[model samples]
Target chain A: MATMPASPAAPSSDERLARTGPATRIMRRPEFGAAIGAIVVFVLFALVDSTGKFASLDGIARWTDSAATIGIVAVAVALLMIGGEFDLSAGVMIGTTGLVLGLLVTEVGLGIWPAILLTFVFAAAVGAMNGWLVVKTRLPSFIVTLATFFSLQGINLGVTKLITGTVRVAGIDRGAGFDSARAVFATDLWEPYRFRIAVIWWIAFTVIATWLLTRTQFGNWIFAVGGDANAARNSGVPVHRTKIFLFMGTAMSAALVGIMTALRLRSVQAGQGVGQEFTFIIAAVVGGCLLTGGFGSAIGATVGASIIGMAFIGIAFAGWNTDWSFLFLGLILFMAVMVNTLISRRASAGATK
Target chain B: MTTLSEAPVPTGEKILELKDVSKSFGSVIALRDISLHVEAGSVTCVLGDNGAGKSTLIKTLSGVHEPSTGTYEVLRKPVRLSSPRDALALGIATVYQDLATVPLMSVWRNFFLGSEPTTGFGPLRRLDVKKAKQIARDELLRMGIDIRDVDQPVGTLSGGERQAVAIARAVYFGAKVLILDEPTSALGVKQSGVVLKYIVQAKERGVAVIFITHNPHHAYLVGDRFFLLNRGRMMENWTRDEVDLDSLVKAMAGGAELEALAHELESLGGAAASAAEEVADVVSHPTRGEDTR
Candidate 1:
């Protein structure tokens, strides 16, 4: 019997083999494709717009306002996706929150501030319910949140008609706290430019969400829970807590959008935000957040919403019917996803040693 | 002090010990009558084939399963561990075959998944990204794992490199007994050698390393003590001086079974010579060249 020799590779291989250069490191970022797509879409819209208004401040604000509403929800959904869950109820939750606030202020004879606060509480409960059901049942969050989406859609329509005898509720501005609530949620800024306050909230949300996702311990947990929940649980990460918070956070973001819409219109329609959940998901995927989870960033979703906003308003500026925007969005999603898949394939193969 | 083989034998205090340990699920005994001692500053290789109770032995030791009989001791003190967390608290970190890493996360994040370094105060406290990245780089460098960039996603790493990173993490976290579950089972020759090198480094750092692998070549190269398991039973145990590579392989391949086959093949003589070599290669490299069979 031969005694085995020690490995010659036993000599220290720890010489910092070859540090990845800045360029390669940049390419590996989950949002790299989204950043490029945002720029390309911006340039294409600028070139196509016949009125040259797409380049102007007000036009930028017009799309940014649209983008901000979608951006706020997209950011939360991005984090949810990163944490390996989804909130299909996000769209209708917006309508539900708004209708809740509208009915409380008008029918229940409550002040606007109290009504808004109660609406947030209700939204948080719904979000918690969605998360608890997903974790407890071990069901795919897709199925769980899908059920939530249908239930909330029914509540938004049924509850509104049941109380008001109409599909819409109006006159929320007549409440005592209406002036302050409008200032907080619906106030216009840079009046000449027609900028909505939602843009500021959107930017703030993106920055805070970006910081939380990339710069905090909770952020690391988000990646872990999504990457492999079993591994994350074995590693002693609070996987359930991380997931629950994300679900609740996403629901609250939708509620904020709902508040903004209700305050702006002083009315709430039963079907106001129906079918918009797909829009938020579209922005997230376009921003490079993988639907499978564990590989996306909040900033990527923000960029994705920006792209959507540009397409929505840019199509109109270019003298085309605004209905073409959905077709335009489908094209961008396919193109961005294709680009992302190609890049990630190369990035995953980038291990040099 | 240095007579020849520098590899230390199982001496000094035992970091972990199993005495007449047996585990079972109903009537199915996964492990029975297995006794082993892992001493500090040594590599103890657990050798076995597919159903040789290796995983059962691992689970029993790592607090994944409670032994049905006998005592398991940590640092000479007999105790019971309810979960992996309890074992980890006692510095018995197990780097399983999968490495338990988040592939999309950066190396630093993966390095400190459960235990993150924090700075600042209260709500302002964050991950301390700069410190985490630096420590991840430094700790891996200590293990002689030449990582390219700490910021790169861990999925981009080779299998061996990822294992090295996991091992380094265990060491940095002050693990006294590092349990590596089939660290080289999924690696090629060159990559396996890379991991084997780190096993030596880990031992030199005074860790009682439990190196689990079926490959006799890897086990023989670094293993100072060997415990052979077959069908949920301890077939034999030997120190470095008592066993060599061929015997280890024969035992791992089931000594009686291989001998019977050897005798049967001898009857076939010259025509079976190539077939015997093929079997030898398959036995030697259990992890590779499997498709040919």
Candidate 2:
């Protein structure tokens, strides 16, 4: 954190910065603080857990599995945020997509393969609607997605009860093509220690997202639109297209998590994934995403999710109530932000002189 | 619409000619009777005070806003631009007052931005990292901009360097007509000189540069043709041989100096004239003083 520049700096030091000065190099990365935070939290968990199992390979698998779902959504949320918008309906859309898939398989008697395809299209359409509404109305995405959040929440509950008379939908395993779907989405991997396929999905998503953000034309536009939209628009960037794609991407990622959950548990509740939007948002922010937008990384969100995972399982392993995880994450988030701010400020101040 | 034209092949030609162009934002008029010609290999400056419709003229030319009236000729053919992209399609690029460069993004990324060079196809398509870096470096070098690294965030560059990078990018992307909005308005004296140097460099490379500024000194340093705008109208037009630094400054001041001179004369003469009258009248009116009272 001490290495990153805090403010915009003059061009002379830029020469030295190009040489990879430790301080200048670190300041360039928005996620440096988050990386450090993740490391600290991991070490603390390993050292303090009363059960030594927290340090084992199985423990790594346990925490990683917990982190995978949130990590997947958080990275996409981070990208959307970098493009300067929010998708508040993400958590609810998870429920919405999952329920739609569950019902199609259980009641509609559709194969998992077909059900999944329909579910994806459904989620994408809803996402496209959210993006379109945001661009057309020129409303703050917070307000826009909030409307979506409430709407989807109602639909998930109302339609589920209307069809099943119960909040939960089960018998997903009995549906045709369930085994293959599980193999793709919910299977366990590695011989001795079972790891969820979702973890592999999370890693792949992060890599692709990172490449898309940092190594593509679209990635450049993401930063431009987020930093200043009018300026970006004036520069010939298709600002609306960039934003809409981002919104759709976020929703689709959440839907992937929804599919994985239903396939693994063999059921999805009507209220599934409700009120969990904040977790994805918090994880992104903790991963070094700027709340104001235009600055963050996909890897950073992944690192942030690991912090949450560590706290969730570490508290349990240390013989403490798992509820302490929330308090622990909250404190870590505040500290990470403070550390990042202080370091960047100093780096910028030094550059001007 | 010459997207196929390559850089370093600039033709010494008339690129953009605007005649009596006018723009109104609903009820408020921003520009009227605006006429200017930007010639390739020359620096044409649009000079104005704050709110003097410089931005409107820029927007109109760069395709951000279409002129409500008059003919905007590109490459000797009149056309109405629907968007900045349209203007770019015709080889007209605008560098705005609030620069479009993303501060958190690397220099190379900001340079290639919308027209980024990429390889492969579809979802597998990725930016040509080496090519982009090389070009960014080469372009900056061409502009005489000494950037230490292409990967550094653009915000680290001083105001002047950033403007230089924007100019270099405009040139590298084959912009025949470059419109700069207050490029040196936010720069220091030396930094302003640096940007002025790049304006000349662009001109040497045969790019028609429109350098907009409120600073007469900066304009005089590089401008070959100057257009003075005020209150939505063209106040004055001067070629390089026709205008001097003093006249340019005086015009930009909008008669403030003349008004101040009149005020100074009124106070200086009134006190002296009144005092002389009192002494002369006292002597001349001594005999009639008792009667006058």
Candidate 1 lDDT over residue span A1-353, tens digit each = 22223653443343235555677667768789989999999999999989988989979988998999999999999999989888899999999999999989898999998898899999899999899899889999999999999988888778878888899999999888899889989998996898999999999999999889888899989989998887777677988888989999999999999999999998988888878888898889988888778888888999999999999999999999988889998999999999998887776564533
Interface DockQ of each model: 0.37, 0.29
Give each candidate's fraction of reference contacts reproduced. 0.53, 0.45
Give me the candidate number with maximum DockQ: 1
By summed lDDT, which 10 consecutive residues of candidate 1 chain B come out lowest?
B1-10
What are the runs in model 2 whose C-alpha is more than 4 Å off? A1-20, B1-12, B256-293
Q: State in Å the error of residue A141, model 1.
A: 1.5
**Candidate 1 docking quality: incorrect, acceptable, medium or high:** acceptable
lDDT of 2 at A328: 88
CA lDDT, every model vs. true structure: 0.84, 0.83
**Candidate 2 - chain A - TM:** 0.93
Which tens-of-lDDT digit does each residue in B1-293 have in candidate 2?
44425444345577788998888888998998888887888988888888898878888888888889899887777887898888887788888866668777778988888889999998889889999999999889877776777987777777778788888988888888898988877777666777788888888888888988888777887888898999889988898889877677667665454445545555667675566555444333333333211
i-RMS for every candidate? 4.2, 10.7
- After superposition, the stretches of candidate 1 with alpha carbons farther than 4 Å from their true spots are A1-20, A347-353, B1-11, B261-293
